[model samples]
Target: MKFIKTKLLLAIMTSAIISAPFAIADDTSFNSEIKKAIADSKVGISFRARYEGVDEDGINGASDIEATALTIKSRLTLQTGDYKHWSIGLEVDNVTAVIDNYNDLTNSYNGSDSIVIDPEGTDVNQAFLQFNTQKVKLTAGRQRILHNNQRFIGGVDWRQNEQTYDGYRIQYAVNDTVSLDYSFVHNANRIFEENSKKSNNLSGAFHFANAGYKINKAHTLSAFAYVLDFNKAHAMSSNTYGLLYQGNFGAIKVNLSAATQSDAGDNPLSYDASYYNAEIATELGKITLLGGLEVLGSDKGKAAFSTPFATLHKFQGFADKFLGTGSSTGMANGVEDTYITVKTTLNDVKLAATFHDLVSNEGHIDCGTEVDLIAAYSFKKDYDLLIKFASYSANELSNDTHKLWIQVATKF
Candidate 1:
């Protein structure tokens, strides 16, 4: 925490030094307006609060009644405009409850943290500083990192306070179609606190690097490599690397991604994880169609684990089907799944539906199938109303009954 604070202070000082000479520069209309805004204090504010509920369900013989969760988040943004180019961002997050156990969605019991996020925790959600120009952009602090669809990689979203990285990042644009992206993390506020055999410790530093490229107007790609050297006692850590490709052809688009990971072994942890996901989307006038498949593999019979510390809402499904590994340790080590979605717009209203089927990648036993429905209507203004519903039924486990949810959001 102290290291992150020092970096933040350093960024502020750097920006101040670069802008000192501009204190007396002759100002034009645009420049004067910018100066005035800064004088008044370059600042912005944003907030979000959401409520969700799930109907009765059972998971692995455990019974779940109905349950609900509420969360609120707010952010403050400060920026500067000068030949120096600089800005600062900070975020605050709070939640009313964790994933209610009655709904059976709470997957945090053994090993790592749970997949859902309405958890109990406090501290700033994020804080970062940025500098940018037509050619280069740089930022440092605790912040959110989002890529493509956030499938194979992502912060667990089911929580009110999302995941954030305490780090520095840079980007350089080579031209209209090509660019470079890089980042370094000194800390990761994972979804849950570090569960020592007895005490809960959630403090640490981790590092990583990432880059992106565009092959053409219709094709784009990205790559990443990271090493998570935690601040505490855990051995057999791992290194991760991956590639992603996306392409568009007129009304149709396809995305293919692959990743490989290696670990030294965590105590008795079965190290290494690999996963891939593919999807195709087609525009049919007012309606869009989507179909995709995903698979996770491990040396043992377990699903390749994603960032359990991430915002889980960004993965598997909004219903959060595949929250974590089907098994952290087992002989069958793999999980395969597929799904399809349909999206359409009616005037200012949007609608979408999805279906999913899952199973052990190396076994024939059915994991389950889920259906999700969503709809939204936007007022000519900045306000919008939304409704979401999810349902899942198991083919074998009777306790795997079902779950449901509904939500609404507004912004200006």
Candidate 2:
């Protein structure tokens, strides 16, 4: 039965993709519009090659794991110009393993090597039909959606294969200062590629809504609500509501957010948790300093707040030690992340460093501390070179681990 439903959904999407242009075309100028649209369409291509190495201390008296992976991703995208306020977009991506010594955490898990999440596969990254006007925009089919810094929702573009959604999205600009955005997501195409043995995709009824108001030129406030009901991943089903505020005061900037989550759908857990983030940033001479505290509160060690759909690597720490929070395999005690970052640019090279102090929210267990460093240089308009490193020292959390990455990318 499930297989039949899946096939039916795919058929509908295929039909929509094939018939969108005709559905939006006018009978009189259909041929001319089609020709014009093709003439004005754009194509994009990009490639990224990276090498990652990981070293970890032995756990449970097992041998220490050391591994390296070299991988490359190629992407192609096309965007057709508007014809009667309608357009089409398509993106395809392929990830290839040049050196596969490390476990991909998918079909390549060898039990002895450190894990790298970049699996090898080719798939459609995004395919969407969009209709746009001055104040309103609508999109349907597989698409990428990012809301307000991607703390709650985002396309995990950092990975070899980005995370995208099969969904419908709409955006409305209510005058200049107020705006609204919403998406109804039916499936989540995760970073784990289609060939993975793991549950690489999630089928769900997910609704995301946000409203933004510009209080003034330097201040913006937004409110959001997300309801996620996964068909198979019941533990991740939850309802979250939050408010965010960003302010720029002369040389200083402030960001504050607060959210709450509760069990929903068929989730067996009955719990409520709170989430909070506060950060401030300011520039000093050639350097920028940022400090913040992010807390994912716990419900008496039974459940914790989690952002399963977020770009998890951008938060907690780059080592990704706390990505499994709120799930059966995750930390039920929740987490408290206190961190600071320094960024500077010199000689056309961008440099950043961050430090994190992690601990459990309920049990007060010291999780670990991590230091991350990154240096990136962009040249020749569309070329980039990057080097990054992370070291995590454990206390009560996972193992002591270190990771390094070197990457070069070009897009045109």
Candidate 3:
């Protein structure tokens, strides 16, 4: 029965892709006949198919566990024409697992395979009402919100379903170089998918604010604050304040960021911690070289600097050794990551490699090391192919693990 269902879904998705060009062409022609129907309105479609494999040691007393997953993400979006400064958008997304040789953590079958986060399902991804002007924009509904650099907050787009928020957001441009952004989040729809009995939602009165200033082409600065109050998960609630500076000097680019975090709004414990980050990069001809250091400190083992809602996969390491705790506790101990990266483009193909050395900030223990590699090519204007891999060598932290991914994505 599962096999039949999977095959049927694959066929449907294949048909959708094969008919996209014709559908788009018809939409364009139909707009001309009814200007009022489609003048300012727009439609978008995106599809991504990915194959991922994971090999990890020591799972449920097993020596090693390996698993593979083939997942497809299909999204369709529609927006009506603006009418008196009001426009509405609706997006539906579906994720189908054609080859489910892994544990999605959502299925009745369990323990036979390693855990793969991408679960198969279909759901309403986004539905929002937007009001915009030259200087101010207001949006309310289920949407994706990415703050500066996605360090503290972001839509975890790497996952199949993708994380989204149910709330309201506002942005105002004070001037050409200054702006203010804010959001009030009522609930956070996590990436675990709705079927997983594991807590897939977080509800709270979450407030986020940021003020940014662009000094010039070479420099920019921003300050931000986040006050999160979790009703269902109070232990994860916290308040944070931070500053970020990004600047460039000729061919050298630099990033300096720092933040302080403390328990807030019904948290069981009282603790404070700090975070620091620094990075510098330069391009030598076609190759770019970069190095950086990041520190997430702990307050006497009571609390650690945390970004529970961050796009953690983009940081720490691609192997995702330190995705942080879902709550304010974060890592029970402090962490420090020192890393270097190289990037270049060759024959329309982009390539990047990074190496990381992980350590403990409190006891200064050598945690682990990891290497990451990525290659991407855009074969057509609307199509792309990507290959990525990550390997982590453990010392005393976590376990030795390796992951590989191959993906093809299209947008229209």
Candidate 4:
């Protein structure tokens, strides 16, 4: 009978992990039912758990080896104080992949191996609400929005599933360093896990707005406008404006940004994409030198996109690689590909390098190329240990790929 109910849910999840630290003090009466559900309601709850792994090489359908996951996030809050400016937030995530989205497990226990979880399951993730005064800050349900170097609209955090925006957000602070932000998704819980976090059942969705400027001494600038209404019909939406600059001279620190995108109207292939990002850092005393560059531009079939709301491995290259969308010939279209990163850190040792040039900005073909390497170490201030590797080569698409990532992250 279904392998005895999958061996009784893997023996009740391996006896709840050997009785969970002696039953965690009997769960304190279910955490007092979450503090009596906010006892007179000023409510608050917090939780977080993240685990990730990726070791690949199965020739570019993505996901080749060691794909592990476990994202158990719970955040709940409700407030009505600070003088009625208002606040309310709710987040619940129950992602339990527990190693196998690309861990391969010999391709799903060679078939019919069902422990039931992730048949496109587990979510809620966030249910936003906020309103602040002193220069406006208004937010409306389902949030997690990001901008300014999110490349387009962040909050991916290298996936164990992230990307939230059921829709509506706005923040304006025009002084004390300038600010203006807006996000409108209307739909996109995405990340069951991909295809733009999937499920846009179609009927129109996605919109964005931003204007950030701080120009006085070593600048900060942002301007963005976006719209994506995919009710199918060749689905396309675009509008973007960008500029960013960060500065420091004595010890060397610089950041530069430039962007230009068009095609919010007039489809039938109008095309757009122009981006250039540069970063340089220096320390020389304990070895902390870094370099960066990010580029994506090619409009042959409307590609060059990012910011599915922010944090795609912190600006494209934590080796999650291209973060999604882009396929040649039959079309996937997202990652025209261009990369360069060199890093350094000394203390507990960390070094990194990356190189990629997969061409085909459509009729701008070269098809594929990649090279990556990393090393990390740190222990006794919490913990950290990592080693990563990558090599992908596909000329004119398909065949040749390899990836590996080993990681450890913790916070308390």
Candidate 5:
């Protein structure tokens, strides 16, 4: 792979610095240097509290139940100042379930009640050493990684516990209009930390690459490739290549993207699938109208395209029926979603409403429909409040489901 060569280059560059001659410094000098670096460091803290409720009925296998989850997540972060082009960051995270009335898939309740994925846990969210220059940057250790819009790889921040990776990353800026990024991920630490055995985290050789170019202020394009080879969860391993474009013309905006996927190393099955997405939006007065269509194709009912490490909650629908597995038939019968949205701001409150029509990719089965509503207000520079709701009505596919969330967050 191209990333392998890039990784070797990074290793060589890093080793050159490490193997350079260095004179031993006196204890006083060493301590002074450390103190200076600490004095120049920056520290930050964040707290988020959320109350989420889910009510679903008429589901097969799992019993229909109502669930309420009151979760509080706290984070403390410190970033040291650059010392000879090197810096370090440490972030600690803790999520506490103040009130838990649902089945967090990993908890003892497993599948007893409506699923609420936030489980209680404390973890080292990010601990990385970084070397940065004007054009190139390199980082290593456990850290949060988000590629593009978090479509293929991302930190699942919607859940109380965020996803992180143990890996090395390199980013280079070719010029003002072009940039490149690559990361070699060996292990992924998923959201379910307290229950490691049930955690969706995977050990793998994952390579992520992206190259982006800006034609101008109103237009930009990116190409990305993701290769995943799992050691244990072999069935989910795959490779994907895609391109993305975003541009604005006057009051109108547009986005187009497409990708193809196939089974990769260690995958238990062999299949090929594809994905396509396009969106357009326009603004009039205070309101904006947006429409989009997304398709995840199937390999002749053999397998469907899947992005297991993505922030799945951000796509399809907020009701989250399509979050875990790839398609309606587990490994086959892909998904096609058509959606429209209206958004505006009034008296400092941002509001949006979205409607989605879903179907199966191959047989064109009517999957379901969903309506989403959101209202948010940044009450202070460091504080915000949000209320969101999702209502999904069933068709021939899944059952009816509804979810509601009220959250308050603060950062400093």
Candidate 6:
């Protein structure tokens, strides 16, 4: 398989190299078009510096843990302007650690420090070629792919080393109200960085499809299917089908989603599970109030629904106690999360707070409760400051934990 993939890539490169000169020789305005594309190119750079602290109570007879990590991420990107409906994009990322007192999970042993998952490294974040027309767009190579809300398939951009896919994606706009999207992914570059011993990468033949329709000005509907067949991580391979709905009324907004999943590929487990989410939000004067219920169902006591490719930190609690849905993470019985959020802006600073009550879906066991707080300020639309906190009180699941983060960012 590796040989075949290598040969295929070589063939494509060879064909592109061989055809470019002939096309250029035949076209009289090729030089002018190339010059125009280069003149219209764009370059972007961004940086984010963050300090994170974590403290968690010990489990069993282990000692309490404390960790602190100070890291900075720098990104550079270049995008060429369109030339005959074709363009190119390139992006690179580097993460550096100034203070590394935490266990990054890349080593074989962690000693006594708590886990912080970010590793220092440099990577080619994205390099893609794109073709665009009036109603169709196609992209190939390493790129970022995101779906609605990023609950299931997302780039996980919150992490220092964001997740991206080596794949081909195509989109078509049937009309102003209807659209379709499809992708074929062969590799997933995870957030754990490259050269990690944790096997943070996954390779497989993954297929994704989505169709969306705007029902009107106030409502939209979408249907999607995802089929993942991992070669080495069989337990993470599955087929999922789901529907999403978003509605915006005069004073309130609504979001609803439902999905079902089953084992696929060479997975040793045989189980079927369901997922559901319902949320509503409304604004009253200066404050915005939102509430939601999300559930991941279990099949007996063996297996549960899982979203291995999702932005897991966005869901569950920021304490990251329930990061996985497998039994290894003590989620064999699944999870039920009921949460509410309150947000308001004061003096140009954005502030928000959230509270979550979590429990097991099948065993009816109390998992825990969490409170999260955030405050962010932006300056001149280019620089920003943020502070975040999360506290979790354990019930029957993991340990009591607290986390804090302070960040500064700039873009140009």
TM-score of each: 0.78, 0.94, 0.89, 0.30, 0.90, 0.93
Scored by CA lDDT, what does every candidate get? 0.60, 0.89, 0.82, 0.55, 0.84, 0.87
Q: What is the lDDT of residue 119 in candidate 6?
A: 85
Judging by TM-score against the true structure, name the best candidate.
2
Where is model 5 poorest over a 10-residue stretch in terms of lDDT? 1-10
The model with the greater TM-score, 4 or 6, is 6
On TM-score, who's better, 5 or 6? 6
Residues 312-337, candidate 5, lDDT per residue (tens digit)?
Answer: 89888999887744532373788899
- Candidate RMSDs in Å, in order, are 5.3, 3.1, 6.8, 23.0, 5.5, 3.3
Q: Write the per-residue lDDT of candidate 6 for residues 1-412, one digit (tens) a residue.
A: 0112353355347536633743453346876787677788899999999999999999997899999999999999988788899887778888899989988877554567888877888777777789999999999887899999898899878778888888899999999999999999998888884445666678999998999999999999999999999999888788999999999998999999999989999988898999999999999999999999999999886788888888889998788888777543458789999999999999999999999999988888999999999999999889999999999999988899999999999999
lDDT of model 6, residue 23: 42
Worst 10 residues of 2 by lDDT: 1-10
Highest lDDT against the true fold, candidate: 2
Residues 1-412, candidate 2: write the lDDT tens digits. Answer: 0112353357447746755665465566786787787788899999999999999999888889988999999999988888888888888888999998887777646467888888888878877789999999999988899999898998878889898888899999999999999999999888985556667789989999999999999999999999999999999899999999999998999999999999999999999999999999999999999999999999999899988889989998888888887775688899999999999999999999999999999988999999999999999989999999999999987999999999999999
Task: Single out the weakest 10-residue window by summed lDDT for candidate 4.
Answer: 112-121
Report the Cα lDDT for candidate 4: 0.55
Candidate 1 Cα lDDT to native: 0.60
Pairing residues by index, what is the TM-score of model 1? 0.78
Residue 135 shift from truth in candidate 1, angstroms: 2.2
lDDT of 4 at 66: 43
Looking at model 2, the pairs that clash are none
Q: What is residue 168's positional error in candidate 2, in angstroms?
A: 0.7
Shift of residue 313 alpha carbon in model 3, Å: 0.8
Runs in model 4 lying further than 4 Å from the true structure = 1-82, 88-135, 138-143, 146-151, 161-295, 298-321, 324-359, 366-412
lDDT of 3 by residue, 1-412 (tens): 0111342345346534533433343456444444443477799999999999999877347688788999999999988675556666767788899999988777475667877788877776667778889999999877789998898998888888777787899999999999999999987777886557556778899999999999997899999999999897777789999999999998889999999999999989788989999999999999999999999888877777778778888987877878763334456678899999999999999999999999877677788899999999998799999999999898887778899999999999
Q: Using TM-score, rank the candidates from best to worst.
A: 2, 6, 5, 3, 1, 4
In terms of lDDT, which candidate is stronger, 4 or 5?
Answer: 5
